[model samples]
Target chain A: MAILDPTTAPRRSQLNQRHVSSHALFKELGSNLVVSHYGDNDSIIEEHSQAQTLAICDLSTLPRIGFKGAGAPSWVEAQKLNLPAMANTTVLQGSGSLVAKLSDQEILVLSDIFAQSKDVFHLSEQAKIYHKNYDKQVYSLPRDDSHCWLAVSGTLASEMFSKICGVDLRTHKFSHSHIAQTSVAKTNAVVIRNDLGSTPVFYVLSDISGVEFLWDCLLDAMQEYGGYAVGVSALQRLTKEH
Target chain B: MKLLTCPLNGKRNISEFTYGGEYHAMPDHLTSSPRDWAEHVFFHDNVAGIVTEWWCHTASSFWFLAERNTITDEVIRTFKADEIYQQRVEFTAVASETQS
Candidate 1:
């Protein structure tokens, strides 16, 4: 008899069913089958080509969670989480993980660390402990299943975003570690500026159900700037080089 | 786009906030007449001068008070209500401690 590993099962993204036929290579990344590359070439060439151009990668499989309510601030503080004191700011903690204070009461934590390390999971588990201990005002807002995360980066990234976003997101106006909870592509989305390499990169978080529509809208905008879709492997390499 | 200064997320578009109506004192239901209660509930002076009003940021759900002029629609200032309330509570606590 063979032992079955449940964790090895390939999890799918919201756009998985729609994009499965389009991808040429699929890699299992932490229980998720993500596109390793789209065409014949390897992800390295794809990454190198995107050095001056734009590349949009789906990162919905990343471990992300939210904390909100009156006691959320204190709870986060108690946990000794590395978050900014002011709202609309982000802090990088434990490898490439980001902790964003969307507001005084609401927080969004994203684990961008390479290889989906145990360190990020440990940080997320601390929130569960806080929820168990302080169940009064602090509320758990798990976003893993609710949000579709995307990484849009490269030289013309800001230009592509300007087409859909209302706010000015140029590096001069919106620097690294800044967050904007505004309309993107006519939809409510949270945009965070966490650059990858020398290129400007942003993490866009929106409703999971609208992921396909948002992806199409973004790709349409990227078309004018010669942008294309890159796999998660290429994105990981870009972040590592930074 | 009209910009409203949020107490937390400073200077955001007015569309991002929801108007919470005028801020006024509630009539004492026990001592006041029905007419007074009705006036408190339905009537508004709609003054052209600067008046305090309630506003909430839709994204963050942060409720705050803004002083604005109805005529020019100019927002004079904006601040968190809890900040003022906390100060009052601290002052009262200090006063009681001094008296004791």
Candidate 2:
């Protein structure tokens, strides 16, 4: 069933709801915020929550591209500080995970969400090239998409996410690069599984308006785990250490 | 964070944009007055599903019309404003008829 069109997709759950939280992300024992989830995996979320009670979502906004052609490898290498492995190689050549030239500038390269040392350099380099050749305009992103990214962390992270999205949360099967375009509480979203060794992270990408409902559904499912909500400001304090 | 791709360039985030509202449709300029122009700039008729909006590439200084589904944030289509507007008059008529 199409996630975007509810009429086409069967509705097994309500669209709007919110999870209850006894404390704010900042008010928690350690650094944490309980407000809304910005989409990020645990490596990204740990920035907000600290104590075992609080959970955080990674809010690193990244860029994406669809590209292909002979110039692909050169284009990808040119954009990144450490060139990626050849188009089909299983290994990722670069040391810095912060910068991702997913595919060549031609193939679809979903760049890393967070801005690291290299993203800035690529932006400036592209801009310089564009200036040199006014005829050829270069496209680069300064901010990630304004998508409401939600993360369900803690021991119950997968359980909470499964409650919202029908897809399985088994760790081994749905690793990175494994994407599921599904629905959560009547809203369409792209769920990506980010493995964080001990606790697996789920990246839920959806509209801002649907965030309240999405958060609520997740909290309800996670109620058994005694989960709490956190806001973006609180996330900053949580991530300060990292 | 809004990520957009120009047909000319490649992937770009939405921060480089000013969402102008559904694109590929004209203001009925032949029958429209200055008031219509003002309304187009100041007013809006928000829809729940698919919509076309004008996006000004603030960083690149280019403008294009993007067809985006508001609910999903998925871009349905996009085109250069200068080239597409000429045909928008006819496109608007067809779109209005479909809505009715």
Candidate 3:
């Protein structure tokens, strides 16, 4: 296949320059371009192995949206989306997206790793539709532009996090449903655990402007464990039958 | 590293919070003089004893009240802003009246 240009996408990741520098191969994911694989690196099989041990992937271009305000919880529940009983916990919608409550009023929704789920888009549309009814007080927060999403996966992923984060994120300490809103590498980030089948995967959402620094920081810390960047294709394999 | 407990997010590294100045009862917006407003916005008591102050959790932007001793720099307790600010305070611009 011919090398695709990320620049062609209307929406692009903030780390596009860094990815381009690292020989990243572009692929379309939900109207945005993401790194399918870093060209000149190991094949997807090798990348899959690297991911099982320690790997970082930029998911900045994936589908994600946030809602906040007094009426958000009820409004979300009205859409038939199952919500976690408490804040700082996440639950998978039977339709496939993940919903994470940041507070009593705020929640963030992310698409399935396969990028096949349209739950986020539907929620976004719902918010727009009901926005005319000011009674709901639910406000839409389009996170795709405001925040960058990155996923760190592997058996040693939690160990790698300790190097930069102040919070204890060990698998024994922080479970898959837990969320940590704290300082990481001196930058504020919302950390959510959503493992890939058996392997642990933590999703970090931070200010988009600071994403480049965070990305570089994660890559630098993971170097000691021979961690490398992988693509979505490799991550998908982790969730399926091996 | 110092640790600060956020009323909403629970305990977190002190670095995760931004001190939003001392919490003070707001003078009635329509009744207070310009000087009173200026003092309320700019001047802090800087008390040496325990005092309530405004703090924001940087990651979640959760604003809450914290009682801390200024001299010792120890936080006594943290609680949600709703404890005191139950009603919304609206500031409407009187543009039409002022246009004259």
Q: Output the number of the DockQ-best candidate.
A: 3
Give DockQ per model, in order: 0.30, 0.02, 0.74
- In candidate 2, the second chain superimposes onto the true chain B with a TM-score of 0.64
- For residues B1-100, write the lDDT of model 1, one tens digit per residue: 9999988777877888899988886655667798998988888888879999989977566789999998889889999887555522211222334553
Give the per-residue lDDT digits (tens) of candidate 1, residues A57-122: 887876878888778777766766777988899988766668899887788888763546453466
Q: Candidates' lDDT values, in order?
A: 0.76, 0.46, 0.88
TM-scores for all candidates: the values are 0.81, 0.41, 0.93
Candidate 2 chain A: minimum summed lDDT over ten consecutive residues — where?
A24-33
> Runs in model 3 with CA error above 4 Å?
A1-3, A40-42, B94-100
- On a 0 to 100 scale, what is the lDDT of residue A192 in model 3? 94
Scored by lDDT, model 1 comes in at 0.76
What lDDT does candidate 2 reach at residue B19? 70
Please give, for every candidate in the order listed, the TM-score of chain B alone compared with the true chain B: 0.75, 0.64, 0.91
Model 2 lDDT per residue over A147-211, tens place:
45565544456656665655565666555434454456656665555433344555665665556
What proportion of the real contacts between chains A and B does each prediction keep? 0.22, 0.00, 0.74
Residues A134-219 of candidate 3 have per-residue lDDT tens digits of: 66468899998899999999999999889999899999999988999987788889999998878888999999999989999999
